[model samples]
Target chain A: MQLRLETKQLNYSIDGFDILKGISINVEDKKMVGIIGPNGSGKTTLLKHIYRALPSEYKKVFIDGRDIENYTHKQSARKLTVVRQENSSDFDFTVEKMVLLGRAPYRRSFESYTKEDMQFADDALNAIGMEAYRYRSFNTLSGGEKQRVLIARSLAQQADIFVLDEPTNHLDVHYQWSIMALIRRLNTTVLGVYHNLNLAAQFCDELYVLCSGHVVASGTPKEVLTPKLMAEVFGVEADIMQLKNGRLQLVINEAMTAQ
Target chain B: MIKNRVATPNGYGDIDKSNISSVKKHRYIASFILLPFLYVLSVFLACAFGSSTVPIEKVILVLKQELFGIVSEIITPSDIYIVWNLRFPRALLALAAGGGLAVAGAAMQSVTKNVMADPYVLGISSGALAFVSIGFMIGGVMLNTKWFLPLMAFGGALFALLMVFAVGGFSNTSSPARLVLSGLAVSITLNAVGQYGIYNAKNISSSNAVVSWMMGSLGGSRWADVWIPILSSLLGTAFFLLNARSFDLMTLGDETAISLGVNTRHLKRLAFIVVAMMCGVSVASCGIIGLVGFMVPHIVRFITGTEHRRVFPLSFLVGGIFLVCMDILARIILAPNELPIGILTALCGGPYFVWLLRKNKGRG
Candidate 1:
């Protein structure tokens, strides 16, 4: 499989405090890769760099094997899209209009969205099972519904890769599974930050465990979700069980206290 | 359950798509057709019902004769002068100033991402007023030139905008609260300077003139005063309409806009410059018309949705109608002892502003 995204020795700091120190990761085409980390482990910071929200160094990050710096914002948007946690707005837009904005990178400064663009948006909404709420106000939607709408917007972008920053953060368990399932159905390269290890294990084809700005472990979920690594990196005691279906279930026992 | 259910044919479920589209079509008609017709009617009314009431027929005849070269035998010279020279230009100035200020306000709100932002609240008008007052104090060829006052006003407005951005920081990192606070500080300081300039004027007549102008009136408007405001308002509205989609994206927050291929910083800088230019010209034309900017956009948004493509043009026409109607009230309320147009706008807008603040307080 071809590498869809690669970040080599990505380092970021703010106000002289190092947030992401020399972190490297690779995601293959048409695979969902998960980054599991504790809070303040630079998950969001790394995602920011990947999405070009924070400027990354030349040759540090590449999409489709080309340096990310070579692409303009519009070109990069066509190649990769993002679904962020902070999707609320001060003003209201209809779900249709909000999803239509995904076509913005394809539009010129003065050009209106074409009929084809609307068709793409509609198809994307249909994919997320949100076509029924097309006319509803975005702010009026529930948390899970809004997240689904946001994911639908990313789908409308028709990008080859998606970078999601905790897209399921505030959703309920049902919504979390549903959203993860929806993403899994996309069949595009996805790099996501996940707090729930079990969900990561259930959905992700590969995993990178980050601790204090470093990739502490990288492998399939069965290889990375060991009890020793969970206790050492996440400061938690856990039991890993294999079900008859060959899925790994992570049962967190207790949090280890600081010595 | 998900597999068994069939999707609605239109895919909008229970929502009546036709009804929604018809409503949208009506809004477009109201914005494009009805509002403009009302604006024209208000201009005629403004021309007809002043301290000396010229008949509406005569008002129409005067406009026709002057504008289209169709000479009228029924019109007298004094009637022509009253309608054509005095009321027509004054009404036109009111329209231009009102529309310009309102559009500027809408752009300001979008750039700052705050509903409460306007040219008046952001100190742009105060800065222009201060510059004009200082020019009045100088009392030279600068004051006599056609473009001098407006030029000074533009410079002052640009300076104040830069100051606000400097203090508040232009990056998304700066909170909206910081922007509003910086605007308040700049407004207060510039207002004091304007007041001091007027208070220590070398002569009484100029001081009184500045004082009345500061209170905001359309009494002295003439053909010479008409073109700048109209041109600026029209051009500014056109520019904003062309970039309406970007403004829509701006309301979604900066980071999201950036991810969607908008160069938010560049867009913001351009928006601020246009806003400053528009506010400066409006303030220079009709000395400190407050709150028309703040109120008109919100009213337009209420009638239309929050989309700028709908909001910008409607704001221009509605703002024009609003001020023309207000000027009529200002002229007739005391019957020759005219109240300043600004006082009426303040009377209406001050309470609305308070209500908005209280409403937004809960959100914050």
Candidate 2:
């Protein structure tokens, strides 16, 4: 699809306070880009805007050079998918049925599901290693399993672009790395928000660091994850090193105490 | 929260280690065998037992004559008419009302993502009450018209439905929390108006009729009352079934729905109108039957799981059967002078509802 995602001069506000101010970025096709920031620094807000969960006030968000507003919801959904961090619902739907909702973009009202839709849903379940738990009720799933199922649902949409907010949040160590590996293996254009600097540096090809709704740094992990940037942006002292394979890594001396 | 946890079924070292797939298959097979038999039995039992308590043979003869127009040697004209025009219509009415109320309840619960949601949640009953009061005030002039009650009730329901949506701020994107709050606010207001009308009426006869109607009795159901509710319920049921997929998606919440390409705002509007129409017709014909809407859906959920495809159809059948049984109880409990069906439903529904609330209190 030669997919590309771009946000130009994006600005957002909630309750008269700016959340994402003058944010601009371009993500090339087939790369995993990580967006990392402190709490309330607008990572989730930016992802929400891209996924159309929150309306953009002043910005241009384009997918493959086409204006986002020009595409209908179905059209956009068919072209892009999203997996959000927050999971809150009071429903009692089974896991398979909930995952099948991922196919909704392709079906019309009163339309019966086709065999291909079932295939896609089955494939998604297989991809996330949730086939064994397909019949479990959603309320019964663990947090990490729920997150993986959410990812599986987005994959079932067959979208070229993915915008995930904290995709690794609530996962154990093994599943966290495995999920990142799967996202990379899919080779879809990905914009992910992360809290773990180590995971972001290990997985993402490029990084965008935001401080107070402004992009403070944007480059490869080696260039942007410097000790100076960490101290300046996050008020933390960190050591940066390059392994023999030539990958950058960060080792934090200590997590800053809460004020 | 963590320390006070109950002994868990799926916890470490629990013996119920059956996989999810096997558990689901077992549940599906059990329900498949159980529900249909129950539905048929409920229908026959509902028809057989009433205040008059006729024998099965007489009931069959009466039913055959009423349905096929065959002149039977055994059954008399009064028995035939009572069975056909009176009891049979009431049974059918019970089925329609039960199924309609249950489907409406399930749809509302899905759309609102609130367990307490039902046809009455959005002032449908208050609207019907107001219309019934208005029909009484207009008296003989309105009474002469055949469709007056249904039309007035539908109009009032539509008004209340619109009022809730308007107050809820149903924009291109609607919020379910706001929709529920708006419904609560409007229902309280309209109910006050209904109370005032009851207080000011000169004759208690008409007011008493309205009160008993609100308590939902099937005793007065005639063939004429049957047609409107039947037609409206069928239409509403068809609408809900057609959009059952959308209702399933709605429970995933608005953000997930948007991701799946559903315009929730439009769906919400349509569901509100259809549920109001069904309940409005029900109230017009049979007063305000409560609890069938709430209990029937939950009972179906216990058996069918939460896939809307199964839940919707199962709820429809289960709801119909539930009301038929409740109606039979109402008729025979006091024999000859039946109690209101609503009273019995409420008596059962209230305790069950409390237990449900308590069970699910912190799970969410």
Q: What C-alpha lDDT, on a 0 to 100 scale, does residue B292 get in candidate 1?
A: 89
Clashing pairs in 2: none
Model 2 accuracy (lDDT, Cα): 0.77
Worst 10 residues of 1 chain B by lDDT: B1-10
Chain A: TM-score in each model: 0.97, 0.92
Residues B219-304 of candidate 2 have per-residue lDDT tens digits of 78888779888887888888888877778777777667777777677788888888878888888888778767878888777765
DockQ of each: 0.43, 0.38
Clashes of 1: 0
Question: Which candidate should be chosen as best, given TM-score against the real structure?
Answer: 1
Please, what is the TM-score per model?
0.91, 0.85
